[model samples]
Target chain A: MESRNLFMRMLMHAVIIIMVLIWVVPTLGILISSIRPASDVLNTGWWTVFKSPLEVTQFTVENYESIIERAGMGTAFRNSVIIASVGTLLPVTTAAFAAFGFSRLNFWGKRFLFGIIIGLIVVPLQMTFIPVLRVYHQVGLSGTFLGVWLAHTAYGLPFAVFMLHNFFSALPRDLFEAAYIDGASLLSVFFRIALPLSVPALASLIIFQFLWVWNDLLVSLIYLGGTRDVAPLTVRLASLVGSYGQDWHLLTAAAFISIVVPVVVFIGLQKYFVRGILAGSVKS
Target chain B: MAGVTLENVTKRFGDVVAVKEATLEVPDQDFLVLVGPSGCGKTTTLRMVAGLEDITEGKIKIGEKVVNDLPPKDRDIAMVFQNYALYPHMNVFNNMGFGLKLRKIPRDEITKRVKEAAKLLGIENLLDRKPAQLSGGQRQRVALGRAIVRNPQVFLMDEPLSNLDAKLRVQMRAELSKLHDRLKTTIIYVTHDQTEAMTMGDKIVVQNEGVIQQVAPPLTLYNEPENMFVAGFIGSPAMNFIKVKLRREDEDFFVDGADLNLKLSSALLDKRPGIKEYANQDVIMGIRPEDLGDAQVEKEFQVSDDNSFTADVEVVEPLGSEISLYFKIGDISGIARVDADSKARVGDKIKLACNTEKIHLFDRETEEAIK
Candidate 1:
């Protein structure tokens, strides 16, 4: 039994190691290739550089510098930050209030309203893009940061409300009753008790919304019209691989930049995401 | 500090009635307990009084003011839930002072009241600790302190000790009685444990199936249960029920049953003339375990007949001061509480005497006491 257990453990470890290599190898290759000179990258694979570390002639910071100064990546980076921040803030705030109402408050047609919200979860984003663009054009909101923010917020709300509603519902009913008996009004209870205790859920939602908005290219293009001034990093990166599809260096640099914020957000809020997911899944 | 009255209060959830039309008066400074089995609506009644539950069809008055529509906070009542619903996010001091703070009491006054309540509950040193940091008993005390600091018109407790271990439950039960005495506040307590009800309540209300069975002092309830349910519910080990028929021998009445024939005492006969109408009719004879003991067969108090038969002991449980003998007479099994030192063994045939005066006679059809 002991030997069989040890064999099983070894098999599991081997499988995990292979899976990790599959995921990490390409990312590692990209990092090495991004720093190496364009000639070295074209001459040999990233692995060849490892054979002669003292050569020093293989490396260069020119790709990063050129991507920023010549390729207009700085403006794109700034636009991504503003869009992601506003997008995250807008969805999370509306979702929190909507979730609390759906979970706690009772009014006419509450179940039907919540059912409509849940149904929206299955509606494809592509199907709504034209209609939304038309509405934005009529309202004079197209090709603007505000229009992009609204579009992202609308697209993000269904799942956000679903995630947060389950968390809000799982909270002990006694806590709300205690607050009520303590003479806390509905708004006070929501602000002081509900919101404070919901940090894990809120953190996870913020991370999710931020990453989705930051990586998105389609919605930003449709609503913001790919204007250089308002275009986010994703649209700018798409433009890097031009209509002719050349310039891999600029494309890779922009892709890395776009990936940076999401990675940071994920690493920072990973614990809360795990906890929030479990909290929503479990009954209590 | 104030009286609470529920006038024909009823609650329903869709098609099911949770609490029937129930009227109760909790007098000023009285400790009243509502005791029954689970789903008996005791907690619902208490919640209705606290204004946590809305009355479906009647009036609720607190201190002579109609409070049926008032919310729990405006009802001036504090409740300690069975789970000790202390705020998990707050320290003990903040949890206790929360109501006062909501009422906009001065900060120093809230602190003073919180400290006093903590002192009274003997949890002064633990005020800085969160509820999660406290033990079960300490959390229960914090829940009580939260109620205490409010200084409300009434205190409603819903089985606050039911979550504790057996030893802690006993200790907390006594402490709660003492607390009530010291505070002299009108309190409505709910529990399914009859022992807690009997020991702590100045007046106990026994309920079952959403109906109030009996409401009286514990001793009165024990001595004169209005029905078979009350008789069996209020006593430990429960009242032993024997299916019997009332028969008259000459002028004296006797209860005849399987393996037993007993004469009804004159005291019971005079008080219960209704038994005369039940002669030769099926009736239930309820004898508490403690009322049966060993006796000389020839004693004048012994009412003998050919129906008296021997029974073999099935088990004997010694409870330090008393031994409970479980025996079977034919197919009918019963328990008898005897002296602890009695030499009784399993499978031994020991004749036990029944106290005729203490036996309760109930109409078999209605399951109500014959009075």
Candidate 2:
């Protein structure tokens, strides 16, 4: 029996190693290609640099320079930051309050309202594009940052509410009751106890919402319009790889720049992400 | 400190009644314990008093005011949950001072009260440490300190010692009693452990199926249990029950069961004239293990002349000063407590004597104590 268990462990390790290589190799290639000069990148495979240390002299920062200065990448980067920050902030704050009400407060039709919210999670985002665009146009919000913010906030609400409500519901009921007995009103308990204790869940949700909005293209293009000054990195990067699709160097640099914020955010909040995900699920 | 009264308190969840019309008066400065098996609504009763749970159909009064519609904060009560419910994010001082701060007490006063509570609980050094950093016993002390800092009119605790280890539970039990004495505050504690109920409570309310079985001082509840439930619940190893028939042998009445017979005491017989109604009917005979002694002592008393029963010892458990002998008499198996020096062994024949005055008689059908 022990031999069988050991055999299973060995097989699992092999599968995991293979999966990690599959995900890591291409991203490593893009990073190496983005650093190397366009001539050397097109000439030799990125693997050759690992075998010869002297070959690293072929590396250049020109691809990054052109992407940032000539392609208006700086403006797109700022636009992406604005949209993603607002997108994450608005949804998460609203969701926290709404989720608390769904989980803790006693109200008429609470279960039914929560059921409708959960049901919304399964609805495809593509189905709401036209109807939401029409509303944005009627409300004089089209072609503005507020328009894209509203669009992303609407798209993010269902999942945000679902995740946070499940988390809020899992907290020990005794803790809330203790706060209530300690002379805290419902709003006070929410701000003082529930919100503070839910840092981990909030951190993870911030990472998720920030990443999704950062990498978004369709919603930004549709709501904020294809204006060069207002378009996010995703839209600008898509235009860089236009009909000819030949600027691999510029594409790689721009993509890497776009990926940096989320990676940094993930690394910063990783501890809380792991803890918040499991806090209310188990005793430990 | 103030007393709490629950009059006709009933709590229901859908179709199930959790606390059924419980009426209790917890006097000021008294340590009252509500004890029962799990699902007996002991915790529910405590929560209702804390206003954590709403009473379905009843009125609750704390210190002369009807507080049925008041929130827990307005009720001026402090509670220690079974899990301690210490705020994990806060240090011991902050957790204890949180209530005072919420009440908008001045900063210096809050600090003083928190420090005083910490000193009283002997957790002053742990004031800066979070609950997660503290051991189970330390966390329980912090919980108590949190309650004390509030200086509320009443204190409610729900199985506060249950999460601790056996040795820690015993240690904490004494500390809690001492804390109660020093504070002199009305406290309503709940536990499933009968030992806690017997040891800590000035007045113990024994409950079963959401109904109060009996409520009295610890000794009164132990010595004069109102029903079979109270009798069986109060004692360790439990009181033994035997099915017996009340039989009239000439002018005297006797209890006749399988492999045993006992002459009824005249005082017991006279006190319960209802036994005449069951002259030849089945009855329950209850006897605590300690009530039985060595047969040699039985010769002096005529009332115990018919109390001798022969049995084979199935097991002998030596517990320091006393030995518990698990023995069998025909089809009936029971335990008897004897001196530790007794030479009783498994499979050995022994004759035991019963204390006639300590025997309890109950009607078989109703299970109510006859005397």
Interface RMSD per candidate (angstroms): 1.2, 0.7
- DockQ per model, Cα: 0.60, 0.77
| Native-referenced DockQ of model 1 | 0.60
Candidate 1 Cα errors over 4 Å, as ranges: A1-25, A44-61, A243-246, B270-274, B294-309, B329-331
User: In candidate 1, residue A176 scores what lDDT?
Assistant: 84
Candidate with the greatest DockQ versus the true structure: 2
Give each candidate's fraction of reference contacts reproduced. Answer: 0.54, 0.77
Write one digit per residue (lDDT tens) for candidate 1, span A155-272.
9999999989988998887788877887888887898788987889999899989988998988998889778889888888888778415555556666677777888898899988
Q: Candidate 2, residues A1-284: lDDT per residue as tens digits?
A: 99999999999999999999997898888888888888777788877778875765778899999988999899999999999999999999999999999999999999899899999989988998898889988998988998899888888998999999988888889889988898989998999888998999999999999999999998998888879889999999888888327867778888888888898999999999999777578865
Docking level for model 2: medium
